[model samples]
Target: MVVLVQKLLGHFVRSEAYCLVNGKDLPRLDINSPAIWKASVEVGADTEAAMSNWEPAEKRAFRLGARNFYLKATGYLLARLPFQNMTLRSLRCLSPNAREEESSGSELRCLDMKLPQVIQPGDISMLMDEYTVFQLDTLESAENIDECWRAAFDLKKCDGTTKYPILSKLVKAVLIIPHGNADVERGFSENRRLLQDRARLTLESFNGIRHVVCYGERFDSDPSSFTVTPEVLKVVRNSKKRYSERLALQKEQSAKRPREEPEAVPNSEGQDLQKEVETAKKMLTNAELLIAHGLKTNDLAEVESGNSLLASGKSRLEMAIQKMAGSKNSLPANDLSVHF
Candidate 1:
């Protein structure tokens, strides 16, 4: 069990990104590492030995042997920790027998049983100084009420033997009626109600229900604080709107553009057309070269080259027209000689 607990602790430490243990961040340790195994073994051995010595016997020669053993073991465990001090005498006086004392003799015996020293108001005051007190109401006819009252009164006694009065000094401790799994049964009832056949539940639905039960008030009271802001919504809406408008404009432009038919080349004009094509190609080439050089020098020479190319292509078209007019006598080629 100790090994299992230690392994679980290690697993939890690794799974939680923000968790710290013993004032240090968790180190990366193999689950089956030798050091972890050794620590688990040591802890298990110590716990087992303590439990074995502390285990209650079914029958004993001494009247309070089992009780005394329990008290001693508890005291040993408590003393090892950085908390309250405990002793055997204080333990016995807190037992059921001590409270039934009806005479002075029995009272003196109870006082005598208080070992080491008796606790006093100063002790109680010191404990109260560090702790808070809560009052609970109970039924007058409740079972074991007398026993409870006796225990509470005995706790106030300062005598060290039977009573140490440390209860008064305790920072905090809870006391309640003895009930057999009532709270557990109530929780099961609530679970059943949430998971009934009428609910048609999935894992998500169950989780939602659980969250509501745990933090519904906080959620319902201030939903905006836990939800996305209006500014975020506005940004999302604007981005989507801009994207849709850009797509629509592209579609409109595509619809408006006219498609041109492929033109055939005429054998009579082929030489002149070829010359024009060559001149256009050279202009394009020069423009690309200029663009490259301009890019290297971070200048606008490429833009000027492109404009000059356009002007040169226009001039070449005018020269081709004049040549055609000047050579009107040279017979025009038939349409059949033209090839697309």
Candidate 2:
């Protein structure tokens, strides 16, 4: 039974391409082959019918079909399945030809005309341990019929390691490509400019801006006539209402608070009074000292004038006094002797 199954599986795996090209259904190899036919009959009419429809050529076709089906199914299933106990060694047993093709890829060159190179088992194992192990394992095991397969596998593994799971899933499931938030942020920037322009716009006009900015699609026949939606207007109105309410609350609270007159600070009267008293005391002491010394007001005036003397004018004053004395001498000794 195992031998038959193995033979069937082998035939299907080998002729997958032929089956797809011909668009023929798979034929049952075990149906007519007495050993498996009895088991098919025991299973039911559907099984029997399926088995009876089997032709040897169709069997080949079915094997081919099965191979094609397995290729796609395994690729998808492996995407979700765990990769425990999975390695190049186990994968080699499942797909010997795939292993050989990967290892001996000198014939198949890349776009750069360089021979395809295989990654080291250690590297592959490390990648598996770090990222989506099952995905990498499946990809490594899957037949590399095209460059896209390797590219997709490598991208998935790399993305899994670098990005958060939710983001990675979004990349795979939604965009089907890895992209940063920069794209979304750019959309927001463009939308904001359109929505908050100097020219007043309705909600519909804003929606138009959003669509054009985010999706890069024109909304109306006349692009100028594009507009936003009611939903956007509702959001804007709610935000404005909330802001106004907050402002009103602040104003009310301010109004409710008690008003108080500003208090006046005293001038420096104490310092002024002290300074005046000291000036009075100094004048009285000066008067008493003048009386005690019998120094007249004229003497006091002379002392004040002397205190006002300039160093530069002192020589000129001395010269003027000498000149006066010389003029008196010039009057003659006889006129001077007559004077008292």
Candidate 3:
């Protein structure tokens, strides 16, 4: 246990920290407090020696760190005190603005609603006094504050309940503070995105763009669906000074785009292809007749059909003229042939 104590004190003898209570002289912290433990261990050497002669800046930093530590340790409880007190005052139609109670230190700061223009001054002195007594009584006697608040909130603001107006105003002020900052931050971000890198934007032009982007954000998935109306264009033209002949010019350009063009057709090459098709048709007919003649051997009726075709006075070989009337020297080395 002595070795453990020595080990911890070895660390704590560094920081300058002690305790204060009841406005009395400072007291050295318990060894359980790490700051004092380390200071004690390192004393009479670097730690305690430095405390005997603290530089101005070092002293400032030490005090600041101590203040921060004190705040962290006790701030949550202190913060709740005012909030609870204000809520209690609000619950009984007693305004926090009505009080000017002497307050000192950061922890006990009270509301300063002195300007009549700010709170619209009124006389609710009796209500304030009654509220204090009621709150004090409730603190001692009421069980389950959550239920008490619910009952208080349920109190209707009829002709008899004079407290409701004051309570409602207080509730509005208290409830909106935390949420209000988020709205302010959102507005700041919107301004940043709008105003950055936009050197040409005057206040008037910026107002127009603000309206455009806000209303047009709904069409963000397909921004082309958002047509600039005449009014919108007018605003831009009035700001930009180019509104007159452009609308007519834009309409003319838009109208000319959808006119149909004449389809392209090649007259010369098309005629040659047409002639080739007709020649292929004639050859195919002659070839079909020759094939049908070969089929006649199996069917005599087909042969009769062939004989009728042959009566056209054009024998199949005569159509080809394969035996050119010339000697072997006159014959061409290659002959025309069709591949399957």
On residues 1-340, what C-alpha lDDT tens digit does candidate 3 reach at each position?
2223233333433334432221111212243343443322222355546666888787667655644454343334333334334322333232232222322111111221311222334634433443444344322223454444445555554566644344334434444433356755554455446644332343345456656665676688367788778886777667665333545677899898987786666455434334333343344354345446446433322233233333322333233333333223222323323221
For candidate 1, the TM-score is 0.16
TM-scores for candidates 1 onward, in order: 0.16, 0.19, 0.26
**Model 2, residue 10: C-alpha shift (Å):** 32
RMSD of 3: 36.6
Residues 138-250, candidate 1, lDDT per residue (tens digit)? 21332353455444544432554423235432211112211247754554455545533222232233334544543534566476655444754554455556666767988
The global Cα lDDT (0 to 1) of model 2 is 0.36
Which regions of candidate 3 fall more than 4 Å away from where they truly are? Answer: 1-109, 112-118, 123-130, 133-151, 156-164, 179-184, 191-340
Candidate 2 per-residue C-alpha lDDT over 156-225 given as tens digits, one digit per residue, 9 for 90 to 100: 4454664223322222332222235775445434533442312233223333444444332445345465
Error of 3 at 125 (Å): 4.0
Better of 1 and 2 by TM-score: 2
| Per-candidate local distance difference test | 0.40, 0.36, 0.41
Which segments of model 2 are wrong by more than 4 Å?
1-173, 176-178, 181-223, 260-340
Candidate 2 residue pairs in clash (backbone atoms < 3 Å): 12-63, 26-62, 203-228, 203-229, 204-227, 204-228, 205-227, 205-228, 206-228, 207-228
Superposed by TM-score, candidate 1 places the C-alpha of residue 124 at a distance from the truth, in angstroms, of: 50
